[model samples]
Target: MSEELGMVIGRGFDTWKRNIGIAFPFVLDMLFSGIFFLLVAGVVALVIGIDVFLSFTEGAGAVFGSMEAGENPQIVEIFGLVELIRPYIGLLLVAFFIVVVGWIIIR
Candidate 1:
């Protein structure tokens, strides 16, 4: 590497080592926030039930199966996937809203 590039890289490392302490609080905050959101998501997913997920997976399987066979999945198959997800869209939206509210409150 060139001399100028080496110096810059060394300085960057030194700066990061000196300032890493400043990042700890932000890292911890994100960790806690992620945990909070995951719990909220779990509760929301429970309320949404397994049936929707099963249907979604089934539709996805059909799409993947076609791809695996080197075929472009037809529009109808894509529509089937969308149809499976359509009914649960509202529940998913509510879950997202709840997570957003929780994030705002935490922040």
Candidate 2:
């Protein structure tokens, strides 16, 4: 059984090596999308104003208490910023999906 498992693992690696060209584009697509998301999120944060964003942090702190104090974390308050950018979330996801699909098709 151990020898059979080793053979299976070796075969999987061989297959992956053979398909590196096909896999590389999708990997680059994922990296590019992540950077794109961060850039867009930064712009959204700036548009919303630093003071407004800080207010949300303050509210989160008040509700969740300090993480260093070992209190139960209240994550919902922290995620409130998501509500502000909710409209763009779907569009970003759809764009990412289309890019990934296009890469896969082209590959």
Candidate 3:
């Protein structure tokens, strides 16, 4: 039993070692996917302004307070989002356009 197990393990190890090169494309895919994500995010942030994220952080406390007071947090969040985004609809549209173009080019 012990000898048989050792042979099985050895064969499995050999098979894995021989096939290790096949994993390179997956690694490269992940690398490029991450790079692509960062590139897109940076472009969107540049277009839409980084203040959008900061505004969410700054307003979270008010949302949480409203939630604790028995208000629908989702509605509060939605309204708050609308308020923040209303002024930037044009910029957001531009960001969306750029991202779509970038995605088409990358893909």
Candidate 4:
């Protein structure tokens, strides 16, 4: 195991000596994506001027009633652009609540 580890380390050094450049656009893309999402989400959260629960509930009620009526709801369309996002949002909210509760218990 020790000999194998040494050989692997030696190979790593040799490989680094040959091709020092590597494709790294994925890291840059992830960084920019995170920044953009945070920026846009912060602005939207601020402009809405209430906690996430209020907006989520209002949006959810509108979407649920619209779905039940078999008519396209403006609420779902405006925020999600797709009907499925509501359930995902609900699931995420539930998961977050669970985490918060767990944290409270541990603390």
Best by lDDT: 1
Give lDDT per model, in order: 0.82, 0.74, 0.81, 0.71
How do the residues 6-82 of candidate 1 rate in per-residue lDDT, one tens digit apiece?
89999998987888898778879999999999999899678666777777788788777767787766765777678
Q: Arrange candidates by lDDT, highest first: which order?
A: 1, 3, 2, 4
| Distance from true location, Cα of 17 in model 3, Å | 38
Can you rank all candidates by TM-score, best first?
A: 1, 3, 2, 4
Count steric clashes of candidate 2. Answer: 0
Residue-wise C-alpha lDDT for candidate 2, range 15-86, written one tens digit per residue: 989999998999899999999999998997687577566666666565555555675455554554455456
TM-score of each: 0.41, 0.35, 0.38, 0.29
> By the lDDT metric, which is better: model 2 or model 4?
2
- RMSD of candidates 1 onward, in order: 10.1, 11.5, 10.2, 14.6
Question: Candidate 2: TM-score?
Answer: 0.35
- Model 2 per-residue lDDT at 23: 88
Number of backbone collisions per candidate = 0, 0, 0, 0
